[model samples]
Target: MGSLRESLNRFNKQQEKCQSTLTSIAASAAGSKASNRTTTTPAPRAVPASTLSKSPVPAVKFSNDTERLQHINNVRKSPVGAQIKKVIDLLFESRQSFTAEQINEACYVDVKGNKAVFESLAKNPKVNYDGKRFSYKSKHNVRDQKELLKLIRTFPEGIAVADLKDAYPTVMDDLQALKAGRQIWLLSNFDSQEEIAYPNDPRVPIKVDDELKQLFRSIELPRDMLDIERDLQKNGMKPATNTAKRRVMAQNGNILNKPKQKKKKKTEISKRTKLTNAHLPELFRNLNG
Candidate 1:
């Protein structure tokens, strides 16, 4: 009975050890699973508040119909289209692609009414229209002085300033620098006052001979403007003003319309009455006789 009781105690002890070992193994497996979850799963990143929130665009306003029309005229004059010259200016200035609906929303124009303009833009070589949106395709990609200089050199006659403004926004500064450097010449049109740029050719230097230089130095201009004017008139030049013609006409009119003075009839009595002056009359009496 003593040995049996001792054997039962030993079996109870072995069972408790086995249970404890199983519990330890299960706990280790659970810990490993929790560790793997922590390592494998990615954490969520925080987004920028600025990127999430955008400011609303301001609405365009005009005081009157004339002001609104002037604004529209200015937009029409922008560098864009061949005929219409309106919608594509927005695309050019923004340098972004926009759909027909988007363009209408931005400009507040009746796209349906100006359907022909949009159709023309689609066919225009300077505009790039994909199946969805349209973008501005610049004719000249001049950004700096070097590119501008290269472009100016290409045209020997001259490039129009109006055309350059279309290519580069800050072309005026580049042109000014070029002019200061004596690398280009800016000439103004007589009637339009539009500037034309010509490249300065360093290869051809202005050369004057000694005789020509002396002739230029010895040139004597007439001080009398009347002589100069007469010579110019003789060479088939006409008077620019009517002042000279008016002066001559005024003088002639005064002479023709002037009043004439009547002469006194006292000369007939002088020869007969010459003897009545005593001594003074005697000296003149021989002449009177």
Candidate 2:
């Protein structure tokens, strides 16, 4: 009798499992039919980070003509010049320092976005990963220049000409020029105790806008192919459909600055109802009656 009871329990669990499998199949079939009947656009689905662990790419925007010319010169000077500039800009703008591999990953995104531009930068002697960090080893490294400027810009109690002399190689020339240009007094009374520091109309670092930053944090895009073709199309930045490559290159930055989708705030949604007061009499009156 005990064996018989055990056999019956096992049989009941198997039956329950079969019932659940059947129920799931029926629901799936019904869902398929519903999907076929629907024509409305569904809400966008977020891709899982596990499935798409790659960071979103963003097109880097040269903040001003000075930066643009600098980038152009970089491309002309070093094979890795463009990439070095890009990494420098990223480091300056970033809230934290990144590893060399991370920098390489970001620059390689350029390779994916623009083959020619990547090749040009790849030929640079100054840009190489030291198995740990990407270094711009130029005699006049922009990375060093920018770092020194950052220190100067954020110098507490302000920096003196003497203090800056060690950091800036051309300090004497810069001081003399400032004096000749009637700007010597700008740093003459430099304080070193105050929290806020602003030195002699120092070259302010370029700041990427919030929108651009969001894209960078989202997309992780590279410098040359600042604008991906797919993104450009969405922003209505299409060429004459058959425009020259040069023409496309000329308009690359313009297209990349295209607006991204703004996330709408979700309000509390109530359950949807098909019946209103007008239809209630015809639909519900019969049921009530």
Candidate 3:
């Protein structure tokens, strides 16, 4: 009975040891699985440093109220109109809508404080205002070459470039192509250099008569401007003062003080010349007289 009890105790001790070993293996596997899960899960992406920071706003400085007022006047008088108009124009060109505050920040102009300006813009025929944002209301929506050409043709004289400001960004490109194709004429003002677009008109060819051609060929253009001036003066027409001619004459020589040629005495020539037969005849005739 003692031997049997000892054997049973030994068997129980072996079973407990095996159970502990299995538990340890299971624990280790669970720990490895947890570690793998932690390693496999991705970390959150880092945000860019540039996106976190905002750009600096530009400041307009004035020395006095008078200068500030003058600047405001100048801004109002500009072809684009006041600060609000400029903001609207910018939005139109960009083809994007923006709030007044966003526009102020983007354009570097503070129009939020000026209620009058906003009122004027809201009332403007070329601008559209939503409850939150402002957009451009195009007078003529010229998107492509065909539309541009059609609009240009509507104006017989010519269409001002400023009038087509609401057109697409590719309007200039279309204009250039049309100009190259001789489908349109782009003329600029002499004083302002402001571009104007004119449609190419194809009219019936006028055949010049031979007599008319001959008459045109026979007509002579005046070559001498002095004759023209003299004729104009004789006809009671006062000639325009030729400043360019005066300047040229002044540059060539002084017109006021002209040096006169010194006249030589007859006796002065007698000393330089040898006595000839011609001189002897004149001397004898003078002596006889």
Q: In model 3, where do residues sit more than 4 Å from their true spots?
A: 1-86, 99-117, 130-133, 137-139, 189-194, 202-289
lDDT of 3: 0.78
Q: Highest TM-score: give the candidate number.
A: 1
lDDT of 1 by residue, 79-180 (tens): 444434556677778777888778766764434346667678788876888977888877778778999999999989998888887665577899999999
Candidate 1 vs candidate 3: the lDDT winner is 3
Model 1 stretches with alpha carbons more than 4 Å out: 1-86, 101-117, 124-132, 137-141, 205-289
Q: Report the C-alpha displacement of residue 245, candidate 1, in angstroms.
A: 16
Superposed model 2: Cα runs more than 4 Å off? 1-78, 109-131, 134-289
lDDT of 2 by residue, 1-289 (tens): 9999999999999999999999999999999888886856587899887779877779898656787567545544545445556765564445234464565465432433455644444555534444444444333322344454555555445555544543334644654554565432344342454222244453445668999888878976544443555556778896334334667778784356658889999654233434556654645443421
Ranking by TM-score: 1, 3, 2
The top-ranked prediction according to lDDT is: 3
Q: What is the C-alpha local distance difference test score of each model?
A: 0.77, 0.54, 0.78
State the weakest 10-residue window (summed lDDT) of model 2. Answer: 134-143
lDDT of 2: 0.54
How accurate locally is residue 116 in candidate 1, as Cα lDDT from 0 to 100? 62
Itemize residue pairs with steric clashes in candidate 1.
Answer: none
